[model samples]
Target: MTVQTTPAGTPMPDTMEPEDDDVKIIADIDEPWLPSILTIETGLPTMGVALGAGLLGVSVNSGRGPLVAFMIGLFSAVLVFLAVIDWKTYRLPDAIVLPLYPALGLAVAAGVAVGAITPTAALTAVISMTAVFVILWLIAFFTGGLGFGDVKLGGLLALVCGLESGYAAALGALILPMILGGLVALPLLFAGRRKHEFAFGPYMVAGALLILLLPNVLVPISRGSLFH
Candidate 1:
C-alpha cells in the first residue's frame, strides 16, 4: 500500500512511528507563537515561579539582588522544562539533574566571591544540602510514593531554598508536594479512584516556587490545616 501525504506537502512514510506526527506538527508550528502563548497563558504563574525560585536561591546564598532573582527565574523555567519532560517520560535522567548540584555549589561560591553570600550563608547552604537529602530519602522510603530522583532533586533545591529560608525552606519543600498531590488526587479520589500514579515533580516545583516568591502566604497556609 502507498503512503499518504500531509497537506503541508510532507509525505508520511508507511512505517513511521505514530508519535512522529505530533512531533512533526509541533515543530511545524511557529516558534515565536510558543513564547507568546506561554507568556499569555502562563504569564503570571511563570513570573511567580521565576521570582520564587530566585528569591529562595538568593536567600540561601544570603545574596539578594535583581540579578540573583533573575537567575532564579531562569532556572525555574529550566526546572519547568525538565519536570514536563520527566512527567511525560517518567524518567528523571541524571543527565539533567546531577550536574545541577555542583553547579549550584559554584553558583554559591560565585555569590560568596561577590560578597552576595556571606561565609555564614555558604555554610548553611552546605548543611542544607545534606539535611534535605537525608530527610527526603527517608520520606520516600516510608511512603513508597517518592523516587530516588525526587530525593536527588530535593537536595539540589535545598541548596537554593534551605539555605535561603533555613527551616522554612525544608517545610515548603515537603509540604508543597503533598498539597499538589492532593489537589491532583482529590478530584480523582472523589470520583472513587483509590490509587493513582502521577509524576508529582511539577507540584513540588510549584510549592518550592510559591515559597520562594510568596512565602508570606504559602508558609502560613502550608503550616495550617488546609488539608483537613
Candidate 2:
C-alpha cells in the first residue's frame, strides 16, 4: 500500500478512492474537451434539440402566432445545445454564448419589425435579462454555489421568457430552474448522497421551455394585481 502526504504534511492512505460525488466534481473542474469533439459526440442531444424545436415551432404558432414562434423555436434550439454542453462539460463556452447575444438581438429586432412584439416589450426583455444576470451573480458571489455560466444562461432564459410572456414569465424563469434542480437533488439527498452538485443549465433550459409552452400560466400573473 502506498501512502500519500497532504499539503499540510499529514499522511493519508493512497488506497482510498474518492466518493462518486467527488469524482464528478473533480471531472467538472478538470475535464476539458475540444469543440469539434463535443459536436461529434453530442449527435443524440442535437437531434433531440431539433425535435424539440419542431414541436415548439408548432406550439408557438398555435398560441402566439407564426411570426414570433420562429424566433422562439430558434432560441429554444440554441438553449438546448447550451444545456447539453453544460451538462457534459460543466462549462459554457464563450464561443457559443457570446455570438448568441447578437443573434438574440437580431431575433428580437425582427420580432419588433414584424409586430410580433412591441418595442416596449423588447425593452422589458433587456431589463429582465440584466436583472436576472445580476441577481444570479450576487447569489453566486455570496453563496459560491453557482458559476458565471449559470448566471449567463439564466440571463438568456429570462430574456426569452420576458419576450414570450412578460416580466412575470421572467420571474418564473428565475425561480423555476432552481426549484427543478432542487427537486432532482432532493431524492439524492434523501438517499444519503452528500456534497453532490449537479448541472443547473439543463433545469434552466427546461424552465425556459416550460415558459414558452405555457406562457398563459405566467401571462395572467403578469396582468394581475400583483404586477399591476
Candidate 3:
C-alpha cells in the first residue's frame, strides 16, 4: 500500500484532509445601524415602566391635589429610572443618585413654600435620612450584602417619604424593600440559581413607590398601631 501526501508536502494518513476549497469561513455580519435602533427600542420598555410608575404616584397623591401629585410623579420617575438602571447594570451612578439629594431639598422647600409640610416635618425628614444612611452604610460595611448605591437610595427614600409622611413611614419604607428583596431572593436560593448576590435597588425603589402611593397602609404599620 502507498501513502499519499497533501499538496503542502505533509504526510497524510489513510483518511484524507478536506481541501481548502471545501472549507468556507463565514464572516460575522455587522449591522451597525441596527444597534442604535435596537438601543432605542431596548430603552422604551424601561421608559414605559417608569412612566407607569409615575402615573401611579400621581394617582396615589391625587388627594393632596395636583401640585403634590406632580411632585410625587416626578420623583417616582427618577426612582423608576434608578431601579431599571440598577437592575440592568447593578450599579447606581452617583451622578444620578446624588442629584437626588438637592432635588429632595428642593422638594422639601417646595412643600414648605406651598404650606404642604411644616418646618418640623422637614427636620424630621433630615434626621430620618441621616439615620437610615448610617444604618445601611453599617450593614454594607459589615456584611457586604448591600451596596453603597442601596445605602444612598435608602437615605433618599427616607428623606422623601419621611418628609411627606413621618419617621414611622420612613421605617415602613425601609422594611418593605428588605421584605421584597428577601422574598424574591429566597426562591432563587432554593432553586440554586443565585448565590447570595442580587440586585436590591429595584426592591428599594418598589418599596419607596409603594409607601409613596399608600402611606395610609404602610404608615400605620410603621407606627405599630394597626387599629389606629
Which stretches in model 3 have alpha-carbon errors above 4 Å? 1-41, 190-196, 221-228
Give the 10-residue window scoring lowest on summed lDDT in candidate 3.
29-38
How do the residues 50-99 of candidate 1 rate in per-residue lDDT, one tens digit apiece? 45565565454333765455556556666765565455555566777898
lDDT of 2 by residue, 1-228 (tens): 434455555554454663333221112323253452357558666767667775765575565657677767777777777777777777777777777778888888888898877898888888888889899999989987788888877877788777754555565567778788889978988988856767788888887777776666545654574445
Question: Number of clashes in model 2?
Answer: 0
**What is the TM-score of each predicted model, taking all chains together?**
0.64, 0.72, 0.74
Question: Cα deviation of 94 in candidate 1 (Å)?
Answer: 1.1
Pairs clashing within candidate 2: none
Q: Rate residue 73 of model 2 by lDDT.
A: 73
Query: Evaluated with lDDT, which candidate comes out highest?
Result: 3
lDDT-better candidate, 1 vs 2: 2
Candidate numbers, best lDDT first, in rank order: 3, 2, 1
Candidate 1: give the clashing pairs.
Answer: 52-213, 59-164, 60-163, 60-164
Ranking by TM-score: 3, 2, 1
